[model samples]
Target: MQDEPRPDELIKAVADFLRDQIAPQISGHAAFKLRVGINALDLVTRQLALSADSDAEELASLKTLLGKDGTLVDLNSDLAERIASGVVDLSTPGVKDHLWRTTLAKLAVDQPNYASYRREMQGSESKEAASS
Candidate 1:
């Protein structure tokens, strides 16, 4: 196993340094570019922290939905083909929930700050609460 200060932590540290130390010293376009770079770093950090579990869950869902096994990319392609052929779609059990979950996972990594994503997350939390 690796030592302390893992990749995500290191990335967060770098992003924090850039935002706290470098960002204030910059101005205009440079500041904008720095902000973009910091955002990219933050996204990478989130992916590193979250992708494994999300990907595993997605893979499991896809395998169950497709009734077969393959790499995530291959399974997704197969699913797409099935959807295109009208053999599997929202009418299929698990398809709708799987798609919604996958979309939410992606949005969590890619656009967590987006208003729609936030709303969807809130709705999901409400549903979970109601079900409990």
Candidate 2:
């Protein structure tokens, strides 16, 4: 909608300034708090950069798996209800893969550096490479 510096870019610039400039000038509790703030900004930037596509993918997957259409929230609730009622489970085709993809997408935004997430991503890449 706007010009060159998009929301994610602006957030990253602010985070970079905080990490590179302000952080070194602070100490103790304030420094820790500044680091937290920078981390939050970085997470927000990742969400802005990644969530749209991930959400769309998730919605499509949900629609296909559940064989119905609705807003994402409503579809997710429907799926949850079905799963709780034993109508859907891991044995259901696509459920396991859908869950894996959705979790990976969330982790990419929330905890890209998490050890388990890294391992899972590596595993996925290996599987893709092997398939190719």
Candidate 3:
């Protein structure tokens, strides 16, 4: 009898199939579109599976920074307010900078690399036009 494939093996097989068979035929923007679609779906799945404990380290660090003077709720509110007002200077070396960078990195990962791809496409178009 054949054994069932593990989940990791199944995921890897699907990724391999996409890379070898599917992505190769896609052209230009289509390739980036497919890659972004897959990345978005993967991120959604990961976010759905996140646990309450996932932010434990960040929460601990926040608590240490805030100290015993205020409630966690108040501290969170104040932090958001300061950040929104641009009053919080993240350029300085501290926990605030760490938090800002972590949040920004997550946002950066979600952004599509379309600007660079668009420029490349435009360059190709201009070259083709000139040649013709």
Please report how far candidate 1 places residue 34 from its true position, in Å. Answer: 0.6
Tens digit of per-residue lDDT, candidate 3, span 1-132: 447774445555665677678888998999999777666555554443342233554455566665534554576676678678877656534656557544543433343245754565577689999999
> How do the residues 28-124 of candidate 2 rate in per-residue lDDT, one tens digit apiece?
9999999999999999999999999999999999999989899999999999999999999999999999998999999999999999999989998
The global C-alpha lDDT for each of the candidates, from Candidate 1 onward, is: 0.97, 0.97, 0.58
Q: Number of clashes in model 2? A: 0
- CA shift of 108, model 2, Å: 0.3
lDDT of 1 at 107: 90
Tens digits of per-residue lDDT for model 1, 47-120: 99999999999999999998999999999999999999999989999999999999999998999999999998
Which residue pairs show backbone clashes in model 1? none
Please give the TM-score that candidate 3 achieves against the real structure: 0.43
Estimate the lDDT of model 2. Answer: 0.97
Off by over 4 Å in 2: none
